[model samples]
Target: MDNETLQAWVEQVSRDSFGRPFLHQATFNRRLRSTGGRYFMRSHDIEINPKQLETFGREETEKIIKHELCHYHLHLTKRGYRHQDADFQRLLAEVGGSRYCSALPGQTKRVQPYRYKLVCRSCGMEYLRKRKVNPAKYACGKCRGKLFIKMLDFVLEP
Candidate 1:
């Protein structure tokens, strides 16, 4: 949806869920990554990730709107608005907002597997390492045995 519609929707949701009118701007932010929405403390403006709507549709997007509104309203009223604050938690639960802002599709960080392994020649103990390291510098924690480094050729599936 367009910014106008999003703005209207945010205002309506603010009124309906929080019983407070949203006076600040609400817009779709294309540059937002990982997070589904954001509430700017300085401007009191709310930015919704357009990718969220495209990926999850209106039902889930409404929850994200609620989440941002929780931050917006609490921050404006001089109450605790941060994620760790009790007031924010209470209001968010009352409004039925998403527990956490979900990452957009294909926006989650990928984990790289270990590229090397250190083996204890005397005790058969093994240690996985993310990067190449000299085995001569370290000894096995259990047996203090001599160690050898082995490069791994593991591939990660998408």
Candidate 2:
């Protein structure tokens, strides 16, 4: 849906769920990656991630809207608006808002492979490391002996 539709939806949800009118703007933010929606404390504006509607449809998106509205209403009224606040939690439960947004599919954190390995000279204990480090500055934990560094082969993707 367009920004205008989203704005209307947010305003409606605010009124229905919290009995408060959302005077601030609401829009779909394409750059939002991990969050379903965000509430700006300074602007009192709410941004819903468009990907959420595309992925989870209207029902889930409404819950996200309610979640952001909880923050919006509570913050404006000088009450606890943060996730850890009791007021926020109680209001969220009353409105049936989602505690946390579902993680987007295929958005797992990237894991870097070990680029270097440290081998102890005496004990032969080896440790894999993501970054290169000076082995001379460190000693082996198994035995107080010298250590050496070796670069591990990385498989390049085409």
Candidate 3:
């Protein structure tokens, strides 16, 4: 969506979901490759990754908006807005927003917290991996069958 449309959407969502008005700008940032969207602390503005909408569609993008709104509203009200904050967690869960900022391409450091994982097609075993490996070249450790990759969200240390 264009900037004008995005701004309107953000404002509408703020009123509908949080009972607050979003006074800052909201625009799509093509360069945001690490997550679905972000709320700038300095500007109180919101940025949505265009890739997020291209990949995940409108519904998911709306969730990302909700996620960013949680940050915006909480921060403006002087409540907890950081991901680890109890207030942030509670508001996020209550709103059913994305638990983590969703990932994007070329953002390796935060791409996937677990560099690797193995899922057994037969037994459904999930193994967390810290190092990357060729999924096609490896077999499930538990079933000795083909394995699938399961990436985890990056969790910053408290």
Highest-TM-score candidate: 2
lDDT for model 2 comes to: 0.91
Best candidate, lDDT: 2
lDDT of 1: 0.90
Deviation of model 2 at 104, angstroms: 3.1
Error of 2 at 10 (Å): 0.4
Name the regions of candidate 1 deviating beyond 4 angstroms.
31-33, 101-109, 121-124, 131-139, 145-158
In order, how many clashes per candidate? 0, 0, 0
**RMSD (CA, angstroms), candidate 2:** 3.3
In order, candidate lDDTs are 0.90, 0.91, 0.83
The collision pairs in model 1 are: none
For model 3, give the 10-residue run with minimal summed lDDT. 149-158
**RMSD per prediction, one decimal?**
3.6, 3.3, 11.6
Task: Give residue 139's error in model 1 in angstroms.
Answer: 5.3
Q: On residues 1-158, what C-alpha lDDT tens digit does candidate 1 reach at each position? A: 89999999999999999899999999999998878889999999999999989988899999999999999999989999999999999998999999776676567587877878899999899888887888888999999999999887784332
The count of backbone overlaps in candidate 2 is 0
Q: What's model 1's lDDT at 104?
A: 64
User: Using TM-score as the measure, what is the rank order of every candidate, best first?
Assistant: 2, 1, 3
